[model samples]
Target: MLEQVANGKLTKWLAPSMRVGWSMVETVLLTAAAVGIGLWLRPEDPMTLDADFRWILLVPLVIAMRYGGLVGVWAMLCLIGCWYVLKTSGLYAQQSFPEGAMLGGLVFTLVAGEFSDLWRVRLMRADSAASYSLERLKNLTQRFVLLRLSHDRLEENLLTKPYTVRDALFRLRSLALEESSDTALPAGDDLLGILAEYCQLQRAALYPCRDGVIDDRPVAVLGENRPLEKDNSLLAYAMENQLLAHVQQEKEESYHGAYLVAAPISNSAGKIIGVLVVERMPFLSVNFENLQLLSVLLNFYADVVYAGKDTHLLLERWSALPFQMARELVALGRLREEGKVETSLTLFVADDSEQAGLILDALARGLRSLDLAWWVSDRTLLIMMPMTGVSGLEGYVLRTEQWLQDEFAFMSLRQAGVRFFYRHMDTRSTEVQLAELLEAGGV
Candidate 1:
């Protein structure tokens, strides 16, 4: 919705008034172009209107079809009226036609042109409104399906401690891999399962679209039907650039059929998460509404994944965190990638009480942002040190421990096992070190 077109002098001068004001200008310009072309085709004296002028009549027809449906007809009428008035007064002498036939042709042509434009406007509006309504309906259905899946997941949690969404996804990957390892299907994805359940596809195969070729590697059967890898893959380009590619139907082959429709699963802010492909029986095509429905459904699938991650579990607390924190976190992520700065991993622990919450928040405010990660357990809070490795962590640990002993030594947390932990995370997790710290603090 927010687009910045960078070039063109005419574009620049008209940009501010373009959307609303430009439509009328377009109508006028089109009319002028049509009339000018019409005059070229049938140049006549001001006094004459000829039946041979039929070729030029097409000019008005083209204009009416392009813009200003009813308005175009009215303008043409005004042009004819001016001509007739100019001729009748002897200010101009009208040329001969088979006189009555000329009058008859003029009447017939004017009425037909008037209604032709009206008919076009009606058809276009109807087509547009109908398509829009169908699109909205399709989206609603897809969201309904996604919400239903969310509800099913929630229901499972009622009777037992449910896995987090990330765990569920990992489990799904394992299951998919196991099932498809023997079969000619692709592994490590939950997409096909969702597609099978909803769209009732016979079997959906996810093909790797590299460059301009399709690589069909169903279920870890890599290079099964090898398509040449292009220097740049088409799918990758579409994804990185935020665009869509036309669906390609498959010819008779040993591969699963064409992805009848494909869309990039995008986050709420419209970043591509992954691609969703829906395949179906050969020779079948989806209507506009159904296609829109599929689009909405796939997007909803992406939303639910995010919901299961942070939203579903920590709605209240997450909501309470200022939006600024989220923005800063994203900035930290970008900075960390460039590898310019260093950070130290630290932990914050407090009794599960209001006072502890306040201190943890204050600590959050004081800490420098980095491309970092953090975790909050029942009593302990953890922050990731993307800035530093093991060597930098030792001094930070000692100073931080002493600082905590002085800072909150008066509060219940001091006696209540308030502690901090610093662990150097190499290529592996610092889980064991965290456990030792937690145990030492009797947490």
Candidate 2:
């Protein structure tokens, strides 16, 4: 068995490397065969120089089409080596090199190689896009399933439960915000309790994790607490894949272990900072919808934890700023600092006039779903567009102007008594920039 495994591993490793090896081998063998045919047809000029066509050029052309530019160049070098061998061996006494023929062959080989490379790059890009889309589809499918389940539960318990999930989430957010800084997880027990109520858990534990290591001690427990197993298969799988794993999953059948559910608590940036391990739950709750809901709730809590540190201060300073906008601003600031993404902030201030208010209202309604908008005042609106660069901001302004022209017959925003200010999120402090923007807008 060990021998078989070793061979399997070796095969996997060599599979990708073998393509280049085969290309080299084919280049050598085919070059030799072409030279052999030339020698057989014309012993004096083995390269078939006197022929109407230098057939040896086909070798590099074929290799270029099969492999790429570098390997094709190697094939041309092989042909040159064969020519040197013939000349040095006294079989051919040609002093002048066939530079013209060689150059033309190289040009054709490069053209073919370039064509191959272009398509290869396009194929790779297409595959990457498809993979990203598929991942998004999977996430949306899970959320949809959870939403349907939550809707059904809401209808069934409309009388008993006076609040919807949205209200519960808002309350949870408030609870998380009110948590003291000393604790690793803000409102840990409350979070677990809420999860138990929704996910129907009898026994579960929330374990704080850092840098992919799960702590043995539970931050919160629903029932009798138990030590986390260091080598739990479900935990390992969930952590490795950054996904929720449960007994019902097809891949978990072989090694379900002592836990019924294992889910990673990932922040907005998809970093796992904690793990949720459920030991006892209703058998029916082990299904997909409940598990998905559990995962979603954990993710929501994780996002709150991730953004709470920065947003807390912002919220304290700006009482009127929406919590969601504050969170997104903090996230965008971090992203800008890391040089991972760029975001734009557009502020629209309207004069205290009826027409300006109408234009501002129209602009508010026209904002994209990805954009976060906040009305700093009755006539002042702040919009944050994520992943939009300076050029995107310019385009957005032009589009908005054009839209105003068509919709309200206004030639320009200024003509409509609307003033706009734009700023790109840079490495500077977000709070300082936000203050500067608010001050500029006379807030």
Candidate 3:
């Protein structure tokens, strides 16, 4: 608040009236000094130097260039006024060709002031255009840099094959769409199909595992329904090391003779969640390209699994999800205890349910990507913003209020019953409260 107050004072000092007043005062004082010097240097007879005071005219010219035409004109007028009073008081002798000498000084003042004003106007226009262009260039450069970085990240993560065809691009797009559309983790059938289509593997088996333990039979298989034996060392080695293992013909165990490749499906945290086994060909047939593609696809699959979604509606409204609220709070509490991140929650209440959707749409435009908004009730919205505190939440509320006013100038949204409340959740303390809310309904 103190800083803001100081800034306000600085702004007021820079206003036009303050600047012009100071400039005019300086001009007036200097012009009076020039007139006094002329009087001091005056001869007993002014006819000795008919235009002796002509040199003093430079003072007004200099002031005109420094403070602009208006100040310059006033300074010139004051100089002329002082000369008229001196001549009337009979302190300085009258000059011959007085009209011609005075006319020259008057013309000089008008010309200097006019040129000064012209230059000032031109300079202002040039500065404005330069500033506008520089701002546009800066914005474009930032957007371009962000676009390039996003493209580079996609390339590094996906590692598209060299000389990739249009078909490969289409396949990648299809996978992205499927990954976004499906709420749950990719099923075993989906993995098997990707292996066959992209990795050129015709035989494979998917074994489901939970927390690094394979507790169930094969969930999916291709080309054969035979389940992997429990004693298979190849499968055990892949799961134990959390890596892809290739069986050599000379070193292959008798029980695993038919299988050539075994890979583990790990989650984002590097936990072994499932195991994949394929035996369509020998180890030499599986190139590094195939392995890389497989790894990329599995990593994407792991992300979808970790996202914790069930249905499309739940995914769309994941912020205020009743089922996930307790889990999210638990994770937030752990992070806070570990001194990792900050979190804040904001609630927007609408007195009129009919305008809730409109308010939500406008609010979304003002929120960051990490911020999530969901409707907990018909007239209430809960927004969870990661890495934000109470002060940041206040700024967000003010920005949203301003945006609503700008977008809906015809209607007063704030006066129509939209209200917002925010609190910085002490994640450690709010965990139990969040759990209770989840058990009842979303907060």
All candidates: CA RMSD in angstroms? Answer: 23.4, 17.0, 15.1
The clash count of every prediction, one per candidate, is 8, 0, 0
lDDT of 3 by residue, 217-290 (tens): 77677887456665678877777777677665225445535566788876534666677778684343476656
The order of the candidates by TM-score, greatest first, is 2, 3, 1
- Give each model's whole-structure lDDT: 0.45, 0.78, 0.60
Flag regions of model 3 displaced more than 4 Å.
1-18, 39-49, 88-90, 93-99, 160-215, 219-443
For candidate 2, the clash count comes to 0
TM-score of 1: 0.24
Model 2's alpha-carbon lDDT is 0.78
Q: For residues 279-343, could you state the per-residue lDDT of candidate 2 as single tens digits?
A: 99877667655665576567667755666556778889998998878876876676567565578
lDDT at 269 for candidate 2? Answer: 59
Q: Clashes in model 1: which pairs?
A: 185-218, 185-219, 186-218, 186-219, 211-233, 342-387, 343-387, 343-388
- What's the ranking of the predictions by lDDT, best on top? 2, 3, 1
Identify the runs in model 1 with alpha carbons over 4 angstroms from their true place.
1-53, 63-73, 81-139, 158-443
Top candidate by TM-score: 2
Candidate 1 whole-model C-alpha lDDT, 0 to 1: 0.45
